[model samples]
Target: MKGVIRTILLIALICIFSIQFTMSMVIFTDLDNHWGKEHVNWAANTMELIDGFNDGTFRPDDIMTRIDFILALNTLLVKKNIYQDVGLHFGKGINISYTDVDRYHWAYGELAILATYISEYGNADIEIKEIFTEDTFNPNKPINRHEVLLLSRAVTTPPIEDHIISFKDVDANIPNYNLIIESVNNGILRGYSDGTLRLDKNITRAEAATVLRRVATDVNYLADKFLVYEDIKSRNIGIELPIFQQIDEHESQSQLHQRFIDAITSIQYSAFVGHIPYHERHLYDMQPIETLWGLKNQNYYNVIGNNYYLIKYDKDLVMERKKELVKEGLQHLKLNVNSSFDGLISFLSIAAELLPMEETMNAAEATFRQSDNSKTKLETGLFIMSQYMANNEMDKGLNIHRSLLEYEFADDIKAQIIRNYGYLLYSLKGADEAIRILKDLKDEMDLDFNELNPNAIEFTFNGLMKQILIQSKN
Candidate 1:
């Protein structure tokens, strides 16, 4: 029973992130080649920030209206869990009223919540001057590119310093020059290829999505997505420790629940049991749960039944399993390398890519450069490319990656490089090119992309390639 429960939770987390990686982000037929497609898909799927019309087409090219912007912005804030008590009731009751948006309107609650949220929590920099004029909000008007940035500045964290903005058309004299520049600097707004800011052009749905995702998601959340499936199977290392607790007659429900919570808290979701064994590392999918019910729901453990189990992973099994996988990877590549060092480098490179704010990358790079070996250099380049992609220097990263492909190495390394390159092409180069590259390898290798369970995803090569081959039916 305990094994059954552990298996269930592992499968679910894998399916979610695996498909997210492999498949197309959106179903809107119009989004096939749209430059902003990735943003649109992320906003629609990850944030639940927007949806297509009843006809099934996203109409992504259409100009985003004022009302549409408000609804999406309000959704982003709520989904991000930044604001509390932001519905029709704000703990102080419905405190504000809009002249144009009345109680009868369908989105009245959404509009009201956003307006009140901004007014209550917004800084002096983000005044509602653009929307509210003469006691009436022009909700139907097309939202300008700059207007969205001004409103977003109210909710988002500031862009990192030293970010380049090359909007040749945006002169300093323009009223919202700073806001427009900030948008570009934040990686939200990109001017056309001709170098014109087109400040006054009506923002499209795709463009609006690009603006919203950058404003909503921070570095930590995005990085966590990478580490979610690090287990040998699905990347979740948690397992069930069966605790058989009989139902007490005299004890109240609250009392019994507290006991369960205490038992759960005692089992730590930590990195490792002891010191680094052979320098093998393990990453567990750690979800923080405060209440007993929260713990039960997340782990799929049954507190209601007579038998219960606390969830914890076996560290020895976790790391050893990873070591076995790394060996297989080395064999497939037909390369004679130290399994421990190669695996360590793989994990280190990922850490550098995901947690860029940490000092870990510099140490990892030093080790890479010192080795002066082909494997070290290749993985090190993977790390550097990821950082460059993160910083919006895609062209430079792409060019460097192309050169890495020319490096002579094992079949495994070549496959690794090809897949990694295809992965970039998946996001920046579009799905078709990515699929073609991967399919060729799949055909040549005669590989099976299936995982441990038909429904779940494994971190193995086959599981990863599924993401590109499968398009969204949405």
Candidate 2:
């Protein structure tokens, strides 16, 4: 009897352990159609980057937001021990703030730090503020397909150039075409069974997990790209150097306006002017209906530069379509610049840069004067200035610069505005006047020459100053 009782107790113990193990394990019920079931499960179980709902469902089709994506990226960063050596406050010291992302946001710290850290790695010294609306992160916005490719491409070195995209929807001319192709080659991105890359589609949770997995394990991933930031963190490695420093305490409003213009110009120039082989051939193939659709939907113009691409193919056709949209948009702006801010901004930017329509520039300038918000004023003024520059109206552009100089602005903005003024002077008056203006302005701003380098925005201003000074001597 004693032997039988002991055996029963052992059996019960084994059963109890089994129950606990089964309860702890995650099992998804709705992965029948998931293209990346194995990958999602591995990431979910191993990395814990992806999670399931209360009902034990992965909800793979659900959209992933910018905040969530940033969180996952932070997880990867943590796993790689990227921040372990860096100080506890690596990103906290940066004067980076996002209007839409408050302290209450769950991923605020991660998003803030990653934004700063990624900016350090890019070919373009992209400040976090340049990507958003007046220092807003728009954190809750869904991460779209193209953004995934673009972000990955920005950070990782592609294996090789692959112009071929298996998806039927992706044309070779779009801005993200090569990025998508490279991502596919690296096994980081995929297309649907319907043979669509769905470049504008909002990314799903499953897709995000798969991509993150690829970013971590793919042979194409480059760890050396992060050496600069790593070296910065290691104070004992060599002569310690400050990567960036703030300008003077006080800045004029005119200067801030110029900074805004430079930011906008950089964005448009990068988008429309960058070279991608085989893009021109695909540009001619873009259908009129597609252009119309893109204009109506505002379909991630950064991804394809579709409006510009269409214009390049047939300028009159693109402009005619834009006129209709611009008319409606201008009417909305006339209603209230504050109310139709997005539409007005988008319209003005497109019109100023790609189309350079006289009517649009006038409306943008008028809207700037009517607006009370400094952000709006800065944005609209930038659009107007960009339009003038595009139209070769340098004198008119100088007038805009001169008018903004009277307004008080933040220090950073003021520095940029003065830089613009100096450049304009160089363009219209000659190198001597421009050099004098820049020298006086530099002294007034108290710029730290030691902290400035070719990678700095101040470097651009200073470089222009040096070029003018040299030209004057010659």
Candidate 3:
């Protein structure tokens, strides 16, 4: 049964990531001919990061409040799992003791977290010091243009070096000149048609969303030109494996479980080998346990008997089965929104979205509110971080990945988390830290093989470390 469950999970992982790509475009009524229209849509629709007001107006021209910006920022941070303490103060029955902002205000936790993050890690060189040093957050006040740009730039990496400010209204004498110059050079900050940057004016909500969108879509389009599914398949040379003795049917249940676990271990090694054929052979050879469980036509099911529906999707079937599963997953999430089934349902819905089905987005949104077990919560957090990475939100992803180390997970689970965490560290923090973490992970792999089920995460651990070392030198 566990073997079947593993197969189903692997299938889902392959389906969600390897074989799907389609994104729905968002259309907002208020964005017609707006400079920030594409950005707002990308933020709202593709990234699931923002929304329109109840009447459908985005209020592009209205001044955006300080508290409201933080709230939105915090949501994106949490969705990306960037910081562990992000929403801690906002948990149930928690009271914030700030002097100006009421505990009941919607932005309380966000304000608290932002204040804490800035006070502790904020760049001292930036000119935006008054707001942080103030006793009150003044949550309702509209933020000035300079403050918005400063805050937006803060969430991302500061420029490695300063650039000369060419905008007529800005120069070395201006406050936050370095940050402003960096933002403009990077296209995160833009000048008006007249070439004057309105530094002191209050930015609207639509404008703020557009700025966030700029950070989110900063990836190099050229890098992904060769990353299609067929490219992966074309790179594969078939794998050959030594024949294994048949499993004895007379073996006890425990013995069968042990053999299947061994097969799982082989699957992990196959991933390191980076061969699709080896991975498939391991899956096919695993003995299926006799049970009154599992899906009717498929090979795996959940512990309680829910089927994992993934039809073999060659070009012939195309999206037929995936589309059906997506529909089913959304229905499950809608039906089980606040129930105990939320985590599982949410997982399925999110998996569907890798196919780029927007219908499952609500499931991902609703997951933030649902009560989830530690395992589900951890996995969900990982998924959220992956979304951030997908959208070019690397800083956010780095935080979330780093924070996962605080949890007490089973050795196998921790190993998987470390692999992802290590990758992020390499991408964001540099190689020394990533190399240190991965090296420490080697000591933890000395678990008793007799009692533990085999996990493949450790198989690629050395390979990943080597890769990071190579990249670091370059």
Going through the candidates in order, what is the number of backbone clashes in each? 4, 10, 1
Q: What is the TM-score (0 to 1) of candidate 2?
A: 0.39
What digit string (tens of lDDT, one per residue) describes model 3 on residues 1-474? 999999999999987775453324445668788887766776677667766776767767778887777777767655554444433334433334557767666666666565555544333234224434466767788877777777766554433224565767776676556667766754666788886888778878777787766544321111111111110011111112211112234244445434444443454454466544743664543322222122323322121112221221122334655566555554554544333322343344335544563444445545533624344345445555546666878676656555655555665565556666666667766777766766675556553332111244443344455455435534
Model 1, position 18, has a per-residue lDDT of 85
Question: lDDT, candidate 1, residue 93?
Answer: 26
Q: Native-vs-model 3 lDDT?
A: 0.52
Per residue, candidate 1 scores C-alpha lDDT tens digits across 119-231 of 66543144465434347666788988767766775554344333556667677776556655665665566678898878678998988887787666431122112211111
Taking all chains together, each candidate's TM-score versus the true structure is 0.40, 0.39, 0.40
Summing lDDT over every window of 10 consecutive residues in candidate 2, give the lowest-scoring window: 225-234
Preferred candidate (lDDT higher): 2 or 3? 2
The lDDT leader among the candidates is 2
lDDT of 2 by residue, 57-110 (tens): 988888998778778776776676554534433346344587666766666777
CA shift of 182, model 2, Å: 3.8
Error of 1 at 469 (Å): 43
